[model samples]
Target: MSKVILITGTSTGFGKLMAITLANAGHNVIAGMRGVTAKNAEAAKELGALPNIEVAELDITSDNSVNEAISKTLTKYGKIDVLVNNAAVSGFGLLEAYSLDQIRNMFEVNFYGVLRTYNAVLPSMRANKNGLIINITSGASGHTLPFMIPYLASKFGVESITEGLQDELSQFGIENVSIQPGVYPTEMNNGSKSGIHADKPAIIDEYGDTATQQFNALGSALFSKMAEFKMDPQTIADGVLALVNMPKGERPLRYPLDAVAQGTDQEFIDARATIKAKWLAKYSN
Candidate 1:
């Protein structure tokens, strides 16, 4: 059962680890990222050198790039058995402090990027009557938080997509799941990777030291929890593998993988599910 898989944002973090993990398990993996021959050439070369992994030039932000990469994969492999929508950008700022354009830019990568990949891959998946899509969302996707509003909002959008599409595509045997990963010490959170942060210096200044202090405190607490829980990015990669290897109809709609949540994430997920089921029942009746 060596299924063909395509994963976006393979240049780093969970996506990169998933590529290696899945490929090592004998799955055919297309590691998709932007600037394959330019900015990401080294990563592309390194991953391409690995067995069962092929690095493809795929910029999720562009429809053309997404379509081309998916088309090539389908043309070569005939069908993509699974797609991991792991590509996303993170941002942090007060909601009012962020410019509309900055928010849109973050959405371009985090929200629209998922849509691009879905539109590109769904047809072939539907035609084949079988497929799985795993979206890497956030632990806060069910709710909201200060500072990381835009970033979490975008992830929440994906969570919505995953839930709705699960039923919509069920008839065709297609499955969708969202992985809500809490803070892990990946490059994305560790300062090595640049994030779309608040750029309105004037607005930030207006908010003054209070906002800055709160933001700093939140960051410190999150980092501390990450260390205390030993939250490894590999856990996400392993979770993806587990989902992929699961029986076709046995996967849950939402999989929360944050050890730091100490079961509270699961509690939230279950509570939400209960409420949603009740809502659906009322509508059906």
Candidate 2:
């Protein structure tokens, strides 16, 4: 079946790959990005040259952008059968070290961005009484990665939101799904290392050179580990296609993309269970 799909963050990463692949697969793709400058226009032209791909400007942080993109998509496609919330930003640093503005900006993009997009499409979906909402989260949603506290927090919020939406929207015949992809060779992981500033200012008068060296070492290790497990963006796109194609009853609410992510998620769940059990035993009524 050739369904109409709307996707965000199509300027790059999984969004771009999925838009191209889905269009190639004979679906109508409304690819949304922040701005349609000359560069983006060229990219959209290239994509539109394909079977059924179109690009629209959509900044998830802005209500006008989100509304315009939704209106344009509806005007072109009639109705959206699938909505993928893939627009998000990465933030790094110790939790205690980040400023309120920095934290708010992170949530604005990662958390509230998805909410805005979801709200923009819900009215139509509800009226139709059928639709799919796919949220692209991260493996970090289940496991904590050092120095990526803010990013993890945002994704955790996404996980919670998706879970609740799945149950709440089911009554309306809408399906909500979340995909947690492990480290992938995207601009996201490439930009992660440089994007987050250190939480604390350097105390050169006290712990000078050693402290700086340790911080540098930690970042290098993080990047190296990410490279070791990085999967291709196409792998994620394939997983998304599979999840979307599954029958309603058979579809999983959350899909972990790769083996490594599955194992890491299990470990995190087990650790949480153990801690909760211990706490209950220690303070039981």
Candidate 3:
């Protein structure tokens, strides 16, 4: 069955790989990104040329863009079978050094952006009583690391939301899962390299170069390892495909497609299942 799928953040990284792979697998895909006519025009053109793919303009932060994109998707495809919330931005270095606005903006995209898409698509999903939501989170969701506090916190927030949805939507047969990927050499690493929100002059004098210098050392080592063993984006694309093809109610809530052994997301998934079973029993009527 060729289902209609809408994916955000298709301009690069996991989103782009998943969009292309799913469409190639005979699914109807709507690839949504921020700059359809501008920065990502080439990507849009390429994906748009695919037989089952349509490129759409969607800035997940703006409710208007979110609504319009969903509306257009629904009008064309009747209903969306899956919504992949993959649009996310990351920042590194000291959490204290970055301004509040910088952290908030990252949160807007990583956390609230998913919320917008969830709000836009869940109505249709619940009405249909069958749909899927795959949030592309990170290994940072389950584990913490230095210098990446804000980015990891945002992922943690997304992780929490996805977990709640898993329990909340189970009765409706709408699956909500998070893909906690390990380090991959996607454009996201490029963003990480640029170190968005890495420095804050407000507190730099107080802390001096102590924290940032340590972060720089960590980055160098991590980048070297990434060059040696970075996971392919296809690892996640395949995971998404499997989750889509999985029978309803049989899919796990978290799929950690990680090459590195950072957080052991699979072990965490098992632990969560045990916890959910025991914990939710208390609330059962």
Candidate 4:
């Protein structure tokens, strides 16, 4: 069935692809992004021309923007059957090297952005007793990485939200899923898009050549593996579409779309689920 779907960060990367893909599949798409009239004017115009897509300016970090965008969507569409929280900012730096404000800024978009969308959308979703929220998390969200600590931490927070909300909203038939995408050569990772990287030059200088070398080596290896695995951003878009079309109660809580992980991501997800089930059983008893 055709449903109304609102996706954030639709100016580029996975969100854009998902918007296009879902709209092509006959769903009404509200393509949400910042700078709709400024930096992303072309993207907004291009997507807006599509019959199924309505371009909306939405900066997820702002409660007013999120609320307004969702309000308009609900008012027009009558209901949003699915929300794809694909909007997020990525950061890379040593934990100590990042200033509190920088870290907070990253979280404002990556973590709190998800919260804002949920708060805006959940009331209508609950009233309808049917909705699905798919969050685009990271491959390292299940664990952690060195330079990308802050970024992964934010994604991890979303993972936690997806899990907790799965049960919390179960009674209302609202389903939640986090899509853990591996290294895809999107604008975010390919240097076309800017990220909230480490700002403390003095602290970075203190870490010196050794730290630089390690960060460089890690980047090289990740890029190499990404190329080797042929990680396509479209895979994530297709995954979101599949989840949307899935039977209401049959969707998995965590969907990992990392070919580079070579099933290790699935293994980690399975192991974590098993451990969580046992832990919950103990608490219940």
Candidate 5:
């Protein structure tokens, strides 16, 4: 059965691929992109030509834009069966190197942006008492990585928000799920570099240049490693399909899309358990 789905960040990456895939599946997809400029218009045209896709302007950072997108979706589709909050920006560099404004901007797009979209869609979903909200988070939400502090922090916020919503909205018949995808080959990796501070503060002067060089080297290596394990966008899209189609009671609260990420998470869990056991044994004795 085809359903009405609204997805953000359809201009590129997983969002765009999912929008196209779902539309081709005969689902009514309202593909939302930032600004809806000529480039987005062209991308929308390509996706819309598929089957049941509609393009709309949505800047998740702006409340007005979010409200308008929701209003349009409701006006056109009458009810939003699924809302995929996939719009996000990646922030890179040492935490101290970037300005507070840069860090705040990262949260605005990644954390608050998801909130704005959620708030806009919640009313209708609540009224109908049936809906699914899938938040696209990352492995960094659970594990830390060097130099991507802001981006990881933003995803952490997402993890918290989605978990809270899952508990709070269960009674309202709204299923909230957080989908964490491991690094994939996408514009996001390139997009992350844009957030690097050109006027970044100098590191501790004695080791500044060395630190910068090490950071650059690490960043390159991370990207190279990401490429090695990068899953196909369509595979993640298929995961989205599974989430959307899952029976209400059977839907997973959190879906980790990367096998390696699951393994890494388990390793961390085991390490934490060992540390806790050692601490308890020492203190209790």
Candidate 6:
């Protein structure tokens, strides 16, 4: 069935690919992003030119923009069958390197952004009693590694939010699932917002050359893994398509796009399932 879908962060990477792919599959996709009239102008125009893709301004951090975007979509299409929270910003640095403000901003986009979108869509979905929410998380969601403390912390919050919604929204027939894609060659890896290190050189100096070298080495290894696996963004789009095609009430709560089968997310999920089953068996009965 053809459905109207709203996807955040459609300006680039998997969000952009998923927007095109879903639209190509006959779904009406509302691609939401910041800077549609500025930095992302070309992307917005290109996606808007597509047959079923509508580009709109949605800065997840802004409540007004989020409400307006949802209103526009609901008004035009009358319904949004799916809400894909794929928009995220990544910052890389040691936990102490980034300022609280920087960490807060990252959370605004990576964690609270999902919240804003969820709040906007929840009422309508409840009224209709049917909806799907696909949160684009990361393999680093439940845990963290070197140099991405802020990003991973935000992801952990998102993961918790998604999981909570997965259980809570079941009564409303709204399925909430998360896509935890492994490290892939995305623009976010370009270190655009590397973080508060350069500004806090004194702290780095305090940490000593050895700690700095170790952090650099860990980052190098992480990037090497990305180069080695080279996962494609299309795979994530296909994952989203799978959820769309899934029979209602039968979709899995989490999907891991671990291209190389590294088992970080899958292992965590397996352990989680065992624990959840035990808890349900003990507490529910």
Per-prediction count of colliding residue pairs?
0, 0, 0, 0, 0, 0
Task: Score every model by TM-score.
Answer: 0.99, 0.84, 0.92, 0.99, 0.87, 0.94
lDDT of 5 by residue, 159-182 (tens): 889878987998889998888887
Q: What does the lDDT come to for candidate 1?
A: 0.95
- Model 6, runs deviating above 4 Å: 192-199, 280-285
Q: Could you tell me how far off, in angstroms, the CA of residue 65 lies in candidate 6 after the best superposition?
A: 0.2
Q: Give residue 144's lDDT in candidate 2 (0 to 100).
A: 68
The C-alpha lDDT values of all candidates are: 0.95, 0.79, 0.86, 0.95, 0.82, 0.86
Give the per-residue lDDT of model 2 (tens digit) for 1-285.
Answer: 989999898888899899988888888888888657765676676666777888888889998899889988887777889999998877655566677787888889889999998898999989999899899998768656666778888898998899789878987889888888777767776773235444454433255666557657877865676567655689878877887788876776677775545476756655765896799899996
What is the model-wide C-alpha lDDT for candidate 2? 0.79
RMSD of 5: 4.3
Where's the lowest-lDDT run of ten residues in candidate 6? 192-201
Off by over 4 Å in 3: 192-195, 275-285
Compose the digit string of candidate 6's lDDT tens values, residues 99-156: 7787778888888999999999999999999999999998878788777878888888
> CA lDDT of 228 in candidate 6?
86
TM-score of model number 1? 0.99
* Candidate 3 structure quality by residue, lDDT tens digits, 199-229: 6777766777786688789888777766777
Report model 4's TM-score to 2 decimal places. 0.99
Best by lDDT: 1
> If both were scored by TM-score, which would come out higher, candidate 4 or candidate 5?
4
Give the C-alpha miss distance for residue 71 in model 6, angstroms. Answer: 0.4
Show model 4 residue runs off by greater than 4 Å.
Answer: none
